[model samples]
Each structure stands twice: as C-alpha cells, then as structure tokens.
Target: MTNKLISLLDYENKAKQLLPKDTWQFISGGALDETTVLRNRLAINQRLLQPKRFQHAGFVDVSTKVLGSIIQLPVMISPAGSQSLAHDQAEEATASASSRVSTVMVVGTAASRKLETVRKVSNGLLWFQLYHHGTALTEMLIRRAEIAGYQALCVTVDVPYTITAEKDLRNHWKLPYGTEMANFTCDEAGLGIKSNTADARQYRRPPHVPVTWDTLEWIRSLTTLPIVIKGIMRADDAVGCVERGVQGVIVSNHGGRQLDGQASTIEVLPEIVRAVGQKCEVFVDGGFRRGIDVLKAVALGAKAVLIARPVFHGLAVAGDVGVEHVLTILRNELYEAMALCGVNTLAEVDRDLIYNCPSTAPL
Candidate 1:
C-alpha cells in the first residue's frame, strides 16, 4: 500500500482514509473560516515561474545549509505536536525518517515522545521547538534539549494561547487514549493537580505566556544554541529578530491554524527575506506541496521551506517509510523543477526566476 503512494497528496488521501474522522479534522482543519489556509495555496499558485529554456544544465543541486548544518535538500520537517495521533511510533518514526533523508526535523515541545528518547533513535540534525510555558519550565525544557544533543532552539513565538479550529471544537476533539506529551511529566504539566483526575489533555492548555521580542532575549540568555524564531509574518518583526541576535526566522502563520484571514506565508516571504538581508537565515513554510513551490520560495530568497501537515499524512500512512517517501518525492520534484527553470543550484535561484516578483515591485 505504501509503494502505491506516489505524491504527498496521495499520502494525504490515504492517511485521511486510515485516520479517524475527528483526528483527520484536527490535523487538516484550520482556524476560524480557514480562509488563510485556502489563501496559502492560492497565493503560492498565483506566483508565476519564469522558466528559462536555452540554458543546458547537466545536473541540479538541491542541497542547502541551515544554521551551518547541511541538508540534502531545502525541504525540512516542521515542528508539530501529538504526532502519536498519527502513528504509535510518532516522533521517533519521524526522526528516523528525517535521518534517512539527511534533513533536519524540529522536534516540537508538544511531541509525543520524550526529547531524549527521540534523539536516541536517530542520528540527524534536531532542533528543539520551544513553547514558552514559563521562565522555569522554558529554561528546564531548553536545558533538557541541549543535554539531549539538539543542535538549535526553535522557539515558537506564535501560539501564545491555544487556538482551537472550528472543526476541532465542533468534534469536541480530545487526544486519543495511549498518546501523551511524553516530554512533560504528569505533575510538571499540571495534569490531575487541580481536579485530581489525570487528564492528559491539560498539556494542550499551558499557561498563556505572551512571547514578546523581550522573550527572545530571555530565551537567548538561557541557551548557547542558535535560536530560530518561528511564526514570523512581518518585516519589522523579522528585523527585530535580527537585532536580538537570533539565527533564523521561519515565515509561518502556524499553518493557518492560529489566525484566519491573515496574509499567507508565501505572500510575505519576499519582504521578510529583504528585511532580514542576510542578517540571519530566512525560511518559509505554508502551502508548500510541490517541487515548483519549493523552487518559487528558494527563488524568492528563502533559505529553505519547512512542512508540517504533510509529515502527519506520511506518518499515518506508513510510519517512517511513508515519511521518507514524502521527503524523497519533494526532493525529486525540486530537482526536475530546477532543471526546467534552468536552475542548476540553489545559489542560481533569485528574484529574476519569478515573473513580476513581489520583491522587486514597489510597495
């Protein structure tokens, strides 16, 4: 069955068929009307590619570096939580797949596997994704990740509070039995502390600690690892990240899961790239489905693109093998797309490759 899956969408369709309806909705649905979710794909599709016909390139190199770590391709796995919802192996399987493909996987704070346990399973670049629980808990998690041998700290600054999508609320969605936030102990997560009932779902409802730019500074003070700020959408905010000595900015809107009607990440990638201006690495991740999508982003100056929901699709379909297939599909598609566009390497991809590029137009 896994061998039949040819594309990411194929995996998605298969995963949907296999996963429970409520779980599928929780994984696929987005915030409010899900307007931004639709817009993310629309905006990427709207950006036209200018293919150069004459240049004959023998081979295309899709490899690139992020935060000084080399990857075989520009596509990477984004930090997503409750992966156990998709597979029992969960983050361990995802981590193993990432290693097999020679890419980075940002392990989520809400990961279903313990950070150390996930690390022990795979030899690959792992960046711990941090959700600010509080100063003490945040520091503790950071220290744990550092000791666990994670290379960087990807602090997710967007989800200040738990924003449940309409579909999730409609279904009264709850974490399935047997899956838990393995990173947090029941007591540390405040599970059963108040009600005396051990509800694992309490892990989703962490204290609302607003993550401001100052919060970045505080996190910086705590870790020697390079910091990558996720969920950045504005140029000024991206520039602020540079000022604070942050190493990277992932231009994401939380996969349109946090807010609806916001500008898509692709629509804002070029500006964020311009604002950062090589001060730090810039990456974008929203509505990236095909190789052409990856090419469009790289041409627009993104260091790389990260993917989230698709990883779940692969996991649900065939565990680690499906996850590897998903990454391979994108890498192969990127190679072909680059050849069509006469791009032999990521360094050759620039604004000129995009027709009427937004980066060059007057704002």
Candidate 2:
C-alpha cells in the first residue's frame, strides 16, 4: 500500500481513508471558517515558476544548512502534538525517519512520547518545539530538552490561547483514551493527569501566560541553545525577534490552526525576509506540500520550509517508511524543479525565478 503512494497528496488521500472520520477532520480542519487554510493553498498555487532554457548544469543540489546543521534537503518536519493519534510509535517513528533522510525534526511540547524516549531512537538533529505552559513547566521542559541532546529550541509564540477548531467542536473531538502527553505526565512537573483529556469535549490547554519580550529574555537566560521563534506573521514582529537576539524566525500561521483569515505564510515570507535581511535566518511552514512550493519559498529568501500536515499524513499511511517516502518524493521533485529552473543549488534561487500571476498580486 505504501509503495503506491507517490506524492504527499497520495499519502493524504490514503490517510483520510484509513483514519476515522472525526480524526480525519481533526487533522484536516482549521480554525473558524478556515478561510486562512484555503488561502494558504490558493496563494501558493497561484504563483508561477519561470523555468530557464538550456541552463542545466547536469546536477542539482537541494542540501542546505539551518543553524549549522546540514540537511539533505530544506524541508524539515514541523512539531505537532499527540502524533499517537496517527500511529502508536508516534514521534519516535517520525524521528527515525528524519534521521534516515538526514534532516531535522522538531519534537513538540505535547508529544505523546517523552523527549528522552524519542531521542534514544534517532542520531539525527532534533530541535525541541516549546509552547510556554508557564514559567516552571516551561523551564523544566527546556532543561529536559537540553539534557536530552536536542540541538536547538523553537518557541511557538502565536497560540496565546487555545482555539478549538469549529470542526473539532462540532464533532466533539478528543484524544483517544490512554493517549499520554508523556512530558506532562510527571507529578514532579505538577501535572498529575495520566492523559491530557479531562472530558470528552475538552483537552488540556497550555496556560495563557502573557509572553512578553521579557519572557523571551527569561527563556534565553535558561538555556544556551539557539532560539528560533515560530509563528511570526508581521515584519515588525520579526524585527522584534531579531532585536531580542532570536537566531531564527519561522513565518507561520500555525498551519492556519491558530487564527482564521490571516495571510498565508508564503504571502508574508518576502517582507519578513526583507525586514530581517541577513540579521537572522527566516523560515516558513504553512501550505507547503510540494518541491515547487519549497523552491518558491527559497527563491523568496526563506532559509528553509517546515511541513506539518503532510508529515502527519505520511505517518498515518505507513509510519516511518511513509514519512521517508514523502520526503524522498519532495527531494526528487525539488531536484527536477531546480534542474528545470536552470539552477544547481539553493543559493542560486532568487526572486526572479518566481512570476507572481496578476490574480495573486497583493492589493
């Protein structure tokens, strides 16, 4: 069954069929009317790639580095919680697959597998994705991640409060019984619950502590790991990240899960890239599903692009093998795209390679 999955969309289609209907909605649906979700794909699809003629160099290299970690391709796995919903091995399988492809995987704060347990299986680069639960718990998770040998810290800043998707609310979606938020199960951390689910309709929400620049400063004081801020949607906010000594910024709308009607990550990537300039590495995540999407982002000056739902789809289809195939497909497609564009490496990609069709032009 896995062998037949050729593209990320193939895995997504197969995963939808294999997963329960409610679970499918949980993975596929977004906030409110999901206007941002649809726009994310539409924005990317509207852009045209300009292929150069007779400029092939007979080779194309998709490899690049983020925070000094060399990756075989620019695509990295976005950290998502409760991956056990897709497969029992969960993050461990995803980690193994990232290692197989020589790329990075950011393990989420709400991962079903403990950070230590996931680390034991993979020798590849791992970055811990943090949601600020509060001072003590956040500190504890940060300490645990550093001790567990994660290379960097990615702080997601956009989710100030939990917003249950309308689809999940309508379906009354909840984590399956026995699904443990392994990191939070420790009594020492002050969360005594076995699982995050407290009721059929509600799950634990990260405490809504007001995260100010002071919070980033405090987090900086806790660990020496390079800090990458996720969920930056504005140029001013991105400049704020750079001003506060952040090492990187990911232009993301939380896969359009946090807010509705926000600009897609690709729509804002260029300005954030221009605003940040060479001061810090800028990356993006939302609505990226193909090699061409990745190329468009790199051409717009994104250091790399992270992917979330497609990784979940791949995991749902065949665990680590499916994840690897999904990545390999993108890499092969990227090589083809780069070759067709008369480029040999990511460094050669620039804004001129992209021809923004009139329909997608910003007003």
For each candidate, the alpha-carbon lDDT, in order, equals 0.88, 0.87
TM-score of 1: 0.94
For every model shown, what is its TM-score relative to the native structure? 0.94, 0.95
Off by over 4 Å in 2: 187-204
* Model 1 segments more than 4 A misplaced: 186-201, 357-363
Clashing pairs in 2: none
Alpha-carbon lDDT of model 2:
0.87
Candidate 2: how large is its RMSD? 2.1
Which prediction has the highest TM-score against the true structure?
Answer: 2
Tens digits of lDDT, candidate 2, 1-363: 887878888999999999999999998889998999998898888778988888788989999999987899999999898898888789999999999999999999888888888999999999999988789889989988988899999999998888889889989987777565678775434555555455311323446665679999899888899999999999999998888898999999998898998998888888999899699999999888899999998988998899888888988999998888999999999998899899998988999898856767751
